[model samples]
Target: MALPEVSDPQVLAFAAELAKNDGLVESEVLATLEEASVQQSILDAIARPAESKAWKDYRPIFISDRRIDDGVVFYGQHRELIDRIAGEFGVPAEIIVAIIGVETNYGRNIGRYRVLDALYTLAFHYPPRSPYFRGELRQLFLLGNDRLAYPIDQLKGSYAGAMGLGQFMPTSIATWARDYDGDGRIDLWNSYPDIVASIANYFVEHGWERDAPVTVRAVRDATARPVERTTLEPLLSVQQLEAWGYAPTAPVDAERAATLLTLEGPETEDWIIFRNFYVISRYNRSPLYSMAVWQLSQAIARGAAGDRP
Candidate 1:
């Protein structure tokens, strides 16, 4: 089928900028832009991300018996690299693996849409985040530099244009990704060392504190104030929340900054999330995504209730 042409002025302006700033052949940029098609399913999926789901619904989706099992196996197989990456970056290996597990199921599902299509479709057609996706589309072109192992047109990723095992947005790949294996290329898709180190690097760059808590169960009381769950930052300190009758399930520093979060789904759950939790959210900007990574990492580290660690 003939793909519909994209003639949106803003989108065409994007292509012109790509050619002018990035040194792409003008005709080539226009051709590729024209070749890209609008994917309605991608648009729909982008509207309802798993991160918006209830904790109960979102938890099982990323943290499953099989996923944890796979995480353990992944840890074993990449033990040395995982350890080195963690030690070098001061981020936990389990947390590193958990991000990969949650993002792409340990590379089992690294997305299916052509990244070019995903970005272009969203950049021009999706009105709400057009400017953002247009920026991503520009980064997508930038990612085609030496970072990508394949041609940009051939690269596949999530509907949101996140690529590789880590599900890096194009800007992320451009700025934070690395050639950990020293292979002269940053291939987030198939390089384990590159993927591991790149993900750890992202956390370190985003201020992940080592040997600190990600979250603690909040002891809710009648005095507990209503928390804006959508807010990702920890504005309250451990002592402050306790004063409000929301104590941690475990002891915490009185001065440690945390934010109260409540979960609704299979059961009522609340917690005081720390900065590390906030760092994880920077990758996806969703409280549920960070919580899932935190919980799944704990489960992976300890193993299932009946399974061995």
Candidate 2:
């Protein structure tokens, strides 16, 4: 039923039935849903910044020389963990570290949102993606039951309701997370090993390629037009890209296998993307986010090179 239709006795009855099916206490579920307050926050977040502005605001938060350097040094510090995860899941250490650096700055800022509040607000009241949040809410409840951790008082992440070290959605925690440290708990909230392992698992499950490059910068010309941003699957070759006047900065082993991406930069700037670029986007859907990860990863990679005095 729709929001208004949720008042229907039939809808209430169905919710009641669902509660029973999910092994939830019916009264408790009703109380929780009734007291749930997601509308205000959803409205606030929606009515606030535009995506571009949000990107701009978030831009300065990432993509700094210092951050890049930190990433590089951090990668070295965790080289063993990264290597282990890479060997286990086939995800590169640089990308995984980049992801961790991007999501929480190496477990620095997880979030302040209440998991229940965020999920509930978006689930029942945020109409655009209510069904998705609703599913996440269900997942949250199931995750809470795993006995390793409970969602009730857990601190969640930003406006969209992602959680903990990796900023994983509740469903992602249940589905893709792992207990990598042999502690018998998938503690993405704090454990570095679990966080690293889970992130690697996410990339692997999503098809990260160890042999692939993340992205490349293209020299833009006045005649440049829109490059096709296709599905994540590989399609174009490096030679084909050169034909389009965009080439990889480094030598690519594959003759012609990459995706093209165009991004807006400071002062009418732009960039060309590659298959590895799409992999970063898999973690965060935004192109700006992927760029940040790539830039930060590059920074981190440099720091790991022992350039620091």
Highest TM-score: give the candidate number. 1
Clashing pairs in 1: none
lDDT of each: 0.85, 0.69
Q: Which candidate is the best by lDDT?
A: 1
TM-scores of the models, in the order given:
0.92, 0.83
Local lDDT at 128 for model 2? 86
Tens digits of lDDT, candidate 2, 1-309: 223324535326535765778876655555555555544755688566333554556667787776777777677777887888878887767778888787888777776677778887777667788788778877776665453444454545766778767788877878788888888767777677888898888887776777666666656545654567656545877666666766566666547577666554454434545666776677767777877777777667666776544
Alpha-carbon shift of residue 217 in model 2 (angstroms)? 2.0
- Candidate 2: segments with Cα more than 4 A from true spot: 1-14, 46-51, 54-58, 151-155, 220-226, 230-233, 267-272
Tens digit per residue, CA lDDT, model 1, 1-309: 332365677766776787788897666677777778899999999898777777878888987889989998888888888999899899988899899999999999999999999998899889999999989988877666566878888899999999999999888888898898898888999898889989999999999998999999987998677765557788878898888788888988989988887888677987888999999999988788888898889887776233563
Q: For candidate 1, which ten residues in a row score worst on lDDT?
A: 1-10
